[model samples]
Target: MSDPFIPFESISYTKRFLADCYERQSFANAKTVSYHTSYSFIYHLQQGRLYLQQAAQAPIEIKPMLLFYGIVQMLKACVLTVDPFYPENSTVLAHGVTARKRKKQGYRFLDDEIKVQKNGLFLHFLDKMFHVKQMPDEKYKMNFLLKQVADMHPLYSTMHNQDISIAVTQKSQSYMISDTILDDLHMTANRFSLFLEQSPNSKSWFHRQKGITALKQQITVPLHAAPTRYQSAPWLSTCDGDIYMLRKREDYCSLPELSIHYLLLYNLSMICRYEAEWWGELHHTFEGNDLPFIKQFLTSTTKKLPLLFEHYLFSINER
Candidate 1:
């Protein structure tokens, strides 16, 4: 056999190029599935967060639409987790369609799909799972967070339509996005990331590995019922849906003895508190010009969110 010439600049370059090519091929061959279980939902939610973080920290000029797109993906994952069989929104076509045509036209808008089904089974599911009646009307509630995300559509469209050359500017040899817009984007991305991770439904191999401990008795603090002043700073929720207030002074003594479930709940509750603070700032500090959009977004988004999020957001804001 005759010796063959290689095309890459170097051996390392050839290896890296081939690896990337194989990765792309593998991704293309992969089939998309509904995230009906805890595992799939967490996976997609984390992927969305990863992309948002990457977009936020990118040094070069990058469209924030990437972040918004990731948020939409997270939203889809969330809705699917609630109702795996939720019908896809179809703008056209009737029930009688050829298989090939159905496959070709199966594409659906995430926003539209969510909106149509929001008030039905999903809402009922939320109410039952999260105790929606106990959640407050206003605040950085889960519903509010989701609404903020949904309201980004108009902003996304505005950014998406802008001329790239005009939207970005070079300053001191570095490209920069508008300070106001960038700040909002960063805040929104961070909020969504926190919400998804702290969400009660959030579960993963990592969390499982930590080992959960089922308590002997229900704590019965009713963390989600009505907000009441507690002497302790952190509270833990048992698997049976009871809350126990953990005193700050006892941390040193109790920290080492607590189970993974308590530790996780405590950490998640803290994140929820942080989210509330951020929501307060965002609500009060936003410019007058943006208030109308924010208000409208909140109204529409809240209507579409699951009831569980509404309660979760309210429960965390209690402290």
Candidate 2:
């Protein structure tokens, strides 16, 4: 219950932001299906944005609010899964249901990808994730995404689809599903911003109740695709297959209290490493350092750590 936003000095500005990261929900609330859907989506979206920056070789910026939105989307996807924690990964972990499934299946793909059985339920789940429901006008385009563009345009044309530009060698390599997802996400985020501007309901709730919109704003975006770093062997399939830990009461109690700080600290480390890697890449491309700009932006931005714990105090951890 201590502040998760205490900053570290050794890492880059992005890493600093990561080190200080806090979730709007506690591990207890985060383990539920509802939180999983909303939270994970937002996480996935931010990861998607990060992937885009990597592809473009652009300077990394920390937009915690935007990332929070992405985590929500990932949560939604996780809730939809048959087994929230144990979907098949490219590499077998020494833990739960997925490892058992891999052993039974017996066949592996060329790149050690799981030869996932054509389960209708699984495919249905994936379809929903890829297919966009809300259209601009409910017509014109079917929530256009990367799969659509890759199918239509040439490799070069596809590169220009995303706002960020990246140097890729192969046609397939250049086309990232994350880019397309971000386009849709940006539209929704812009719409949400407009909604806030127009309606006072945003402060309370559409129905006269206390809504968690303020808490939701903490994460910037959900993940569109898994991190590109996991695209290689061992982690490839798992990377593609969304791995979400839902907001369930059992899971919440299950997480050892001692591990909570360590778990969070580990993620903080990841954020730092990822940020440093991105910064190095940006330096390689752009020449002069922009760490100061990143630091200033992060320092100025408000964090939702207190709000996250406040929201969860009554709902999940009540005695």
Best by TM-score: 1
The whole-model C-alpha lDDT of candidate 1 against the native structure comes to: 0.29
Model 1: per-residue Cα lDDT over 1-319, one tens digit each: 1211122224443334333433443433222322123344445555655654564454212312334334444444434433333334432112111111121222211111111122332233233323233221211222212122323334434634531111222233222233332243333433423432343433311132322222332111112222211111122222222333211121211111111111222222232243345334435765333334334433332222222222322232232
Query: What digit string (tens of lDDT, one per residue) describes model 2 on residues 25-61?
Result: 2223333443334334334434534432232332234
CA lDDT scores, all candidates in order:
0.29, 0.26
The lDDT leader among the candidates is 1
Task: List candidate 1 stretches off by more than 4 Å.
Answer: 1-43, 59-63, 87-319
RMSD of each: 21.9, 19.7
